[model samples]
Target: MSMLVFFFVPAVIFLTVVAPIWLILHYWTRSRQNKGLSDEERQTLEDALSVAERLEKRVATLETILDAEHPNWRTAREDDYRRGGS
Candidate 1:
């Protein structure tokens, strides 16, 4: 019926076109608004950094032992030509 077409045509257009555009724009803006690190993630990163600092000290101790055992042993920076130093 013409009345049915008149009622549903605009609704179908709104659903198919306007609604999708609105949804896409809304999601795009929301994603932009949420771009920064969350507080929990920042805290976790700080913890990881502290763990890394501890590990670095441990690695330095290991490196000292390694150097003592092998007098001619070279670090990655000392022997640029050698492979697999790191």
Candidate 2:
């Protein structure tokens, strides 16, 4: 029983003290490592932004062309919607 107490006390102390700190530190560093965007992720974000900008400009250009070609296109589209026309 004395030998068991000797080993058990240290094991209990380690579990109560060291184990939690170790777990917290392990997860903290892992989270910190993943906190920032990687270079490839940054490049992908830039590419997505560029494509979005181009698509936005294309939409504006298309709207302008539609305005010139059919001045009442917006109203016509709304009317079509109201009438449930596909």
- Number of the top-ranking candidate, with TM-score as the measure: 2
Candidates in order have lDDT scores of 0.90, 0.99
Off by over 4 Å in 1: 69-86
Evaluate candidate 1 by giving its C-alpha RMSD to the native, one decimal. 4.9
For model 2, residues 1-86, the per-residue Cα lDDT tens digits are 99999999999999999999999999999999999999999999999999999999999999999999999999999999999996
Estimated TM-score for each candidate: 0.67, 0.93
* Model 1 C-alpha lDDT per residue in residues 44-64, reported as the tens digit of each score: 999999999999999999889
Model 1, 35: alpha-carbon shift in Å? Answer: 1.5
Q: How many residue pairs clash in each candidate?
A: 0, 0
Task: Give, for candidate 1, the lowest lDDT window spanning 10 residues.
Answer: 76-85
Residue pairs in candidate 2 whose N, alpha carbon or C atoms collide under 3 angstroms:
none
